[model samples]
Target: MASLWSKISATLPLNEEQFPLQFSNKVESSVVERLRQSRQQLYSNTTSTSRMLNAQIILDISWEKLNTGTWRDVDKEWRRVYSYGCLFKAAALCRENPSEDELLQAVRTCDMGLLMGAAIMDNILQDIVRILQCEVRKSVKEEDEGEHMQVKRRKTASPHVPSIKDGLAVPRIKCPSLESFNTNYLLPLKPVILEGIIDHWPALNTHPWSIDYLRSVAGCRTVPVEVGSRYTDEDWSQTLLTVNEFIDRYILNKSQISPDGVNDVGYLAQHQLFDQIPELKEDIRIPDYCSLGEGDEDDITVNAWFGPTGTVSPLHQDPQQNFLAQVVGSKYIRLYSPEDTDKLYPHQSQLLHNTSQVEVENPDTEHFPEFIKAPYLECVLQPGDVLFIPVKHWHYVRSLEVSFSVSFWWS
Candidate 1:
């Protein structure tokens, strides 16, 4: 854990060791009690709806950001805001499939994101569902055998790689419900955009945010997010760096100004690098406080979200799977699968986390000629678009317009 934290801190410059967090016993106790009560109800009565309700409640309160900085005003105000919106504990209650002990372990060990824990639960539930399905199939086969009193074999078509349309085309209908979405569309590794889903948010209005604003939003405030909780080390000082300075700055310190608007928009530092974007130095509302953050590397790192014009992360991947989501703005994504190891010509040197050494924008075919023929996937991700980059997929993203999105991963 310490190595992970240090690596994260070294990769993205931030005060990792002293990450700030304060959890209230009142909040924690209430949440635990709620879960316990719901668990009891679930075990006692199959007809009870309490399990579902408890799951919903957990989803709603899981992502509340801890109060950053020492200001009581900021703390109280933000808590109220989060409380009002309700954190959708996406991980906690996706489904109830894990055994009681396993589920309890997940709850205790999950990071602030609760990604791994939730996934375990969901997977367990999925397993049960699969088991039931298999039982039904077996019964049907038995019935057929009894009726015919003879054995028979039938030919079946071989499955092929699926098309995005085959995966996500919604049937002509009233609207989409999660229950209706085919499991195939549940992207395992990709960026997703939930355009129409914004209506589900109770506190937020769905007006799209600009690319520049979204990337620079982090510079407006210097709030260090609570590490291992809701945010990582870089996520803590989210507003301090730009698309360009983010990775480079961590290589070493500089006399340069930090990303612009560091003094106000939730940032604690303001130095040379920040002078680039004049708007941050001038007056502007902190409409949004931070930029989109990277997800956990253990589950699905090696991921990115595109921002229009000004947002781009260094090409990189971790030792796990990844998914990208684009809620706003369009991003042009280029991909290379694990088999293209030779074409990518990964670096012979150390100090970088990327597997593809070739320039993503302009490949040197002279040195590495095979890149042209590498099997790749390309897409313009718009609102509601999600691009999955399986583990070891080399990708470069360029935002075509103002974009907002989220990335998902597990360790």
Candidate 2:
């Protein structure tokens, strides 16, 4: 749940054998320029870093919301900035003198890591970029850093906590004193999963849209795949192509065939099951959504599955908050908190998780050194059990049995 890191994983050489990111040179070059400039201004303390954080984090960068199928196509963008190594030089700069501008600037340079880390940080401190933009950060002098914190508590001028009528709240708790909590708790952002939130969740499990899609994968309409994963050997191109054809045919195929073996498609397959549970009409958007898809803030898709073992294509903390709901079979999840960012060896600026899947039951930390001491939160999801994975959390899932789940997110 929390960790205070001494060593950062960015020191290691990146394993090129993992996944090739064919980034769009045109789309990413500007992002790199802004990141460079931000870093230049960091040591100078230009106009107060916190005051400039909003512009650096949200306005200066561009984020694209993509489906699982085509996400790899943008790999080149990641490589341009971090081609030589894990390239986390910025991490060191941040630890020495953490500033709002510096952090935002570093994330700008390492866009992929920023996006991946943003997913996790956003859950805990929702509208973080916005907050930084609105609030002015006056650097506290060496002897006064602690004093400012104390003054914040003692003054009548302190800001008040506002209430939300109907919205997800970020976990930014205010405490009376530092002594009241452990130091480790402060390093990592925390997520507050909303319990008993949606009313129709129960009805979805009993009558899932799994039957048709599971049978389709069973029939081999598309091959079983491990997309963009750092686990087993996988063919990214073929897998992506097959998935594209499946969607085009079933959804836009012009041929009205029964939706079969679709559970393998993941949560986005719910786009097809629109007819199964009419009550869910208000909860989701279908074919139309398939075009626009989920937002960049929270990228979500319904992935369908139906193998004896429901294997995930990859181990990643993509640019989204995942809300996975098992529909038919069961699944076992092994996860590491976002604070373990150093251990995962996450690809800087690339569209993939920092960790490689090595079956945690008996991990091979010799290969994944940081994994040895990484802390995690594991959960077993059954039909109807919705698991919320905050962004940047390293996770691996094994299909307990043939399984299918619907997942969607809006950040």
Candidate 3:
């Protein structure tokens, strides 16, 4: 297998742009180059025996040798190999006439290889799972073209709003200078709504960050969208979908709501979409306020939040200060000071200790009596409004309409 891979590698030039998989410096460039060639051939749909064997060799080596690093390192490396085309190769190389169980074994082998490469890897590996699932469906469709398959669709429940009473709202300022914001809000860890700050953004005017424009530009790019009413819900899950599919099913179509039930909400939340599709990034300029931090503009981490109305981000705190810029629609935001963590009934679960268990809109007094004592601030963020949330401030957000928000996180 090794000798065959060497021969194959000798035939192709190392094309870094085509294959962006990066191995650590510990691995020789020659080895990385060979693996890239094998992955390319595997996805090229070449059914030659030698090509399959070479792909198997690449998988085997990656599995055996890629296990010595932090989980983050391991995850990066595994995603690199998996995304580059190893899983597809494993599926195609099952056999000339493979049984269903045999094909399943191919998936299992690929899964086991990812685990072997990174022992601490524990994510559902949604990217690989979606690919294999699609492959299985395609093969089954090929075999049963004459038969009609009935698909069962489950509609996810929409979030129910509890009653609300008035509270002190976060102060709203129109185009406050960077010095005032840094001196008053940043220093005091106060939440404030700054209006007229995003009018200059190309996204607001020239770029047309609307549904038609996004579909035209980034429809085919694969993205991870959260599918559920809220992250705190038991049914919460993540799936990979094309931007077009997300836009059509969740954004453009109102078919999600019917007498039967509300459909599963798909939210493109907290994703580094700017990094994935750079063309979209050109539309928005980093705010001057973000530069008030110690680092330069490049140090800011920008993320996107897009979802239908009623999408809720349950009460939670983030480590970095955040400026959430409302781009397309309105959002109802509530914030609690970090000092009130004890009063908010923080979750007892280790994974969610930073999140408040009490639903802020309507707290069950019997369960979370202390929550009412937590002084809170609220605001309805409109398009062109930017809300600054201090680090560790417990915040909850619910969209008032089909919304698109850009968030910049910085120290």
TM-score for each predicted model, relative to the true structure: 0.36, 0.38, 0.69
Runs of candidate 3 with Cα error greater than 4 angstroms are 1-167, 253-263
Q: Model 1 over residues 62-94: C-alpha lDDT tens digits?
A: 433343444333444334323211212212222
lDDT string for model 2 (1-411, tens) is: 011012222222234232232335564555555545444443344554442553334332333322223656644443233321112233333444445555444323333332222222112122222222222123213433453344334211111112332333322223213332223222232332222333244335333444333222221122224332224343322231233244333222222111221232222232323222123333333212122223542243444443333344334564555556555666766666776667766645443445455446555678777767776655556664556565566667665544555565434
What TM-score does candidate 1 get on C-alpha atoms?
A: 0.36
Q: What is the lDDT of residue 166 in candidate 1?
A: 38
lDDT of each: 0.37, 0.39, 0.68
Candidate 1: residue 314 Cα off by (Å) = 5.3
Q: Which lDDT tens digits does candidate 3 get at residues 226-269?
A: 99877877888988676767876776554344332235888997
- Model 1 Cα displacement at 231 (Å)? 21
Q: What is the lDDT of residue 188 in candidate 2?
A: 37
Q: In angstroms, what RMSD does candidate 1 have relative to the true structure?
A: 24.3
Rate residue 23 of model 3 by lDDT. 74
